[model samples]
Target: MTAKEGVATGSVPSATPTEVADLARVEDRISFLYFERCSVSQADNSITVTDDRGTIRIPAATLSVLLLGPGTKISHKAMVAIGENGSTVVWVGERGVRMYAAGRPLTHSSSLLQRQAALVSNRRSRLAVARAMYQMRFPGEDTGGLTMQQLRGREGARIRNVYRRLSKETGVAWDRRAYDPDAYEDGTEINKALSAAHTCLYGVVHAVIVALGCSPGLGFVHTGHERSFVYDIADLYKAELSIPVAFRTVAEEPVDIGSAVRHAMRNVLYDFSLMDRAVRDIKALLNDDGMADLGGPEENHVGLWDEKVGEVAAGRQYGPDDGE
Candidate 1:
């Protein structure tokens, strides 16, 4: 039997929504989800889904994940409803369905604590590297190269500058750093944590772009014809979303690096809820009128937003007024 079929008939008990309101409210939050093995059925004007936890019944909207047996069939009406709702529909084994609410709304507030921690940690690491680089590049100045304390100061300033820019652009004031690393950890340890966190953050960004409908290969900040700009956008969120969580996960779990670490990082891509925020934020940014026109018929039409449209227009091989 297929995995879907095995899940449907498996001895595992289904998971039920703890509260009906929880299910109803879920539509507004996470529009996408992963269900390992589950069953969905329609009865008495209500659709019920059974999983290892329990059974949940409510009005059917759009089901993105649907798994049915080889001979199973689905009605066109169901398919239409699913499509109309912008839900992703997946069919697997017999009598199994996984439904994810499409366009799931996300709030920065919900993840503020974790995001703030990540930002602070990342900023610290970046500043540390920058200070080291600066000292190496310019030795024996009046300052005798920046010390760890000086690095912290520079880190704070740079983070604040970036934070202010992001706030002005996005209208969100992120939390500032609260804890001092000198009181808690050494510089080398902090740097190591930061690197691991950054790698995980990159992974999350890639996942988010894939979830959102942007090709990762097209990029904005990291210039290269072959590079994925969407990946760059995702990278922007690493400091605010993924890094802190990865650090905490690694610190708390303390697992040795191996296949397990790789696997754990993959799971953390979804666990930290970075993908959800990535999709939501990217969609907003992409849909904005100020956003540069990235996808079009031009050969080098990279969608890098510039405040001065005339500058980009001048750089363009073909202007909007130019006739093809």
Candidate 2:
């Protein structure tokens, strides 16, 4: 099914003979599946699929992307069948009926790993950029004058304020105590918190892509992690978009505790447009890299992570310490 310009929604016609044959042919391609706006019914070991048009019986193994669109219902047994297939079934509408496929090829494990590596690399790159920007924004500050602990404290406050604003705008709640600058006194705690924050943001991006039936691992900005390019793409927004918005929100309206800060953040998440802009910016970056044709059924280039690692290893391989 395809949606033309300005169409609010589109419908999938009943599967033709060729489409049915294609489904059968690709049955064994992956162990996971996703479904949208469809239903599956089970009788013993076999399953029957019902749509607005009619019903068809097929072996349980032949099913993937089992969609149950709005107003559609499925028995607990059917839900179990769907889960047992290792499929990620999405509820697209109210009635538990509309759904679509969010599955990936089972053989794409290596791709998934490469995608993850790419994501990490992309994250580091963006973080480096943000850090550079921060340094430029405050160039006169003397690093030699302040202890490392003090610098981390300042960064923690900045990050916390940003999180508070993000929580207010996005309506996503996070622990406010998680942002305590003093907690980072030893420096280790702040680093761990940042890492955790990155992982959480990555998960949200992956979920969004799964909903769109896109491959998260096949990314435009964060290329190379096998099953998580979406995460990489999301990282680009963490500092520039999410952080600044979150901080601005917090500074404008003060919150006492971490939970309250998170509560404020939930409001920010309700605006999908902000998230959409972040995705668009990522796409723009990918276009600049001359890799706009990602996520297609073709091999991708070597990831940035691999290149950096290679550079570091080569330097060590030929370093003066090698003879020691």
Candidate 3:
């Protein structure tokens, strides 16, 4: 039977997402998937993608993020199987810009998410997590004496020094780090390199966050944006991985400069084992046992002030009278 037929005919049951269980580590899944001009459907226990070139099979269980780009048609059968495998599917345009939609979490357990929310909600916990993140970036430095403001100042200066040093080393004239996302294609080679590097970092970080069943919105340093936590974590690796790769890309100045920078970023990610590193970093950040109580019923963690924004989402007070 064809893969789609096999899945749809009920000859084989596609496992529910929660039933598959989370992978032991984030790196165990396909970190990123960008599909263009292809039709995706189910085949037996896997997903098959077909384009003008040919057909390829992806083990659905190993998928982390699937970026459905332009000219991509996905069958419901395929979507069902993909969702069951716990893959986050994103619909995007060419060059992977303009994301339209993405999948929800496949997990029933809220332990990791509760820890994230607890850390984000309390001032002390928030600052502690933020410091922990910064400590990861700096490494070996005792930051106990540094206040939040001072830590931010030091981080800014450190990044400036990085830009200046890399500029001097690679002869890439970089005065200030600036990129207008609205006018993305209009930027210079360095700016494009920087943009490319950031997006790549964002993608991988997003995957790790989703894979580990963490809410990308519960950010320590940043807030508001859906992937605020992703941006927060990506900042840890920016100076070490993305910025240098951008500078090196400008130094070489390949014909397809954007492509070259992305290629370089991929090389660095692989060489440094960022997938595994990200998983480890996330585990370390949220491993606090104190957060277990926070994952309980809404009444236990809920308070009178209505401080917990997520409480509304918990369906306790989400009546039809309440504006959604």
Candidate 4:
């Protein structure tokens, strides 16, 4: 292929990897950007987005996540740029009701992932993590003796209270939380708004989870499914973030409540610095040592497991009798 063709097809030399320390902190970055019915390609360090309206350039380094909706086509060069900068790319259905995500993490080490696995594997530690989650939602309250069933019931009551209070304050009619993924449009304005807002929340949270190199399927309070952990983390912010935003959006009576809710949620996420909170919260939840960043160096590493000593250095040849 010609030089121009090679560049366009992303067959040319890849860009140098950026240092993790030089990259923007997740809390300081924009939450997400949504695109649909467009074509995405890389130009230098920026990704060019083209649609009927026009073509625009966006720096790939500053982006946290890109939500590609229906009718979007992204070239390989664009994906390379996104992956190089530790940004996530997610494919979604209309109003973000359906989603699939893939990304490169900011950290190369598996420290946090190992910690999460260790915590979730044991029943005692898992229960502690679950209780810690409940405590985060209900600060200043004791959850030490509460069984899982009681804790769930308490959460239900808290959410019901939030809905009723928000409904009374906003004067938006409230019945119950009813959602059907297959029929998003059939729900009430509030339900539709809630779904849209929560989808955005889940997208960002999922991006954070991936960027940290944690398994999205391993969860504490939530279990099963590929995104069970995504649900568990997203629930931490729903009452404060999505629920209120949904109620207020419906009260405005906008022509398109879904679009309005998404915009509001974007601003809310930024204003609250949720990305930083998510990182710290996950660390605190899994680590008994305390909530520290635990970020590692940029160098890639590997080790071999030794039953007695644990994690011997790899890449060295041993004697014939030493199990090379």
Candidate 5:
């Protein structure tokens, strides 16, 4: 996510609605913005966020996700503008501890989602994708021969090493990963930082998954949850992005650890260009056609499926007498 920039103020514009083609590419846009206790409405080509302080306008076209935290309200006109801009809106609890709802996919095409479903549904393809995911984390090493159990073991060891290394470097005490969701205050400072950082990362990953029209429930490594795919993708970056940040935040011993971690995470995401990397990584992971990019096109399409051939034309009546 890019740094939050200053906003201008204006009235909602009365002009031609935004076209998908006019919107910025997903990789080229700002990852997300979090708002709370504010009123969101449309203003000209931007979205106006008004609070007790004042209202400010944010460019809707370049924003990929809008996170509305507790005590926030939005207008229908603002939602329409955001939807037209292909931006995803997510509702979450304070400090982004809980996720309540999410908006529509940014992409008009369902091609990537179809490919993801197909890959996850088949045993062979699902294993291939899972291995690919492992291969991503273990670059310069081949994981083709590793079974699911072996992969899980390897991953566990790898993460433990990460925690130990980061703890040593930051001089923060390291312990086993422990967190009680119902009791946030019960977790250690590092654990709280980890949760806060991971939640922010999950929010971004969830946005990217849906923006590409991919299913959050269809996952190769994770399953049996509404955000299985979100966890799967978020894991890809935790080692580099969140883990170190959490340790560093704990070392600082900030007054509000969660807020500090979130702020740090946003900057880290911008510096890493994580949004662009995520789009590219997801394409290569799911790309089986040996093509350059498998992220799919931005065009909207609807069609009828056929058995013998591929897809058939949509919006036409199929009559036996006419065909005969």
Candidate 6:
């Protein structure tokens, strides 16, 4: 790509591999953002999100995910800035149901992802990882002798049990896992609650997946879909996070149930410290070395984590030069 094309497309300028690799593990940004009923415009080397309330200047580089909900418009330049920052831009429906996602491809370096690909490529290794995932999901539940079919059946039973328990708690009927992404207007309260909760979880997982340089499509439990690995990791925490949040939100039965669920999901996600837990859990789920593998090769990361380096970078205010 030409330099001009690179600039227009938000390509890295004079960026070294070590720098890119260092950025891959950062967790300082807000985990999620949403834009609707406004225009996202490129202004003065930053993206300005304008709505009825006023204008909010976004340092896109410092955000994990930007959700473009309904009634949103964005400029080409704004898109470029977002991609350059390596932040994900997702077009979503009511309560964060993903419609489309923008932003850059996997850019980080991690030995864990290399190991993950190797395991996924082999039949025995892949199944072992799947079993590991199952074990991680249900702690203290021995599944060493169970086949894949049995594991799936157990997962189904566990989900049904969660629903039944929550149904009793909140009086919201969960006939089955049901929600139409295309028909958001008709989704039942329980279904909407499930979608809201999962959408938040998905955003956090996606950020970590991209940050760790792992392919979201690579999966053991959930196969297929662009967010297969996203689903697999999210399922680990779904029962504990989403189910109760959904039930409680539905029990309120507010006039604007969708909005209420969305608000509640975000609150619980932050209050419960889901982002940090997600990063830690994903590493353990995928590799024995866990968080250690996330930093990549030791030689490549001499002073990346030094406090002085962090203080300098942190002191530099966010602006047009953030990606630089």
In terms of lDDT, the best-performing candidate is: 4
Displacement of residue 89 (Cα, Å) in model 1 is 7.0
Off by over 4 Å in 2: 2-155, 162-175, 178-204, 208-275, 283-288, 294-324
Residue lDDT tens for model 1, 1-324:
001111113563222211221222212332233233455554332345566789775443323223232343444433433332323433322111111122221121212222222332464543433343334323454333556567456545655675455545543334543323333232233233444444444434543443233444544333354324434564455444444443444444454322223345446645655545555555443433343222212322334445766234344566567773
| Candidate 4 per-residue lDDT over residues 1-324, each given as its tens digit | 011222233457555556676666666667999889999998776788999999998887788889898999999878988897788898989877888999888777677788899889999999999999999999999998999999999999999999999999999999998988898888899999998898899889988988887888999999988988899999999999999999999999999887899899989998878899998898778773742342445335788888989888889876887875
Q: Estimate each model's TM-score.
A: 0.31, 0.31, 0.78, 0.92, 0.90, 0.79
- Over 1-324, each residue of candidate 6 has an lDDT whose tens digit, in order, gives 111222322463321112333333336666777667899975443568998899988665566777777899998667766665667777777667765665553353455676778888899888988898889778888998899999999998998899999898878777887778888668887787778777766876787677656788888777878888888888888888888888899888888766776678778877877767876776676664734444345423322334555423233456678663
| Whole-model lDDT values for every prediction | 0.38, 0.41, 0.73, 0.85, 0.83, 0.71
Tell me, what's the RMSD of every candidate?
17.0, 15.3, 6.8, 3.5, 4.8, 10.2
Report the backbone clash tally of model 4. Answer: 0
Which stretches of candidate 5 lie above 4 Å from their native place? Answer: 1-16, 288-298, 320-324
Total clashing pairs in model 3: 1
Indicate the worst ten consecutive residues by lDDT in candidate 6: 1-10
lDDT tens digits by residue: candidate 5, 189-302: 999899888888888888778777789899999999989998998999999999999999999999999879978988999998888888888877888354323234524668
| Candidate 5 residue pairs in clash (backbone atoms < 3 Å) | none
Model 6: pairs clashing at backbone N, Cα or C within 3 Å: none
Q: Give the residue spans of candidate 1 off by over 4 A.
A: 1-28, 40-49, 57-82, 88-217, 221-230, 254-287, 290-324
lDDT of 4 at 50: 99
lDDT of 4 at 120: 91
Off by over 4 Å in 4: 1-13, 288-295, 320-324
Tell me the tens digit of each residue's lDDT in model 3 across 1-324. 123322235575553433433332357665666677889997664789999889999877777777776798998878877776667787755454355445544454566777788778999878888899888878889887689898999899999999999999999998776766677676788887887777777777787777667888788888898988988999999999999998999899788765677668777887877878887787688764444321133323333234655333343665568764
Runs in model 6 with CA error above 4 Å?
A: 1-26, 43-46, 105-107, 288-324
Local error of candidate 1 at 188, Å? Answer: 18
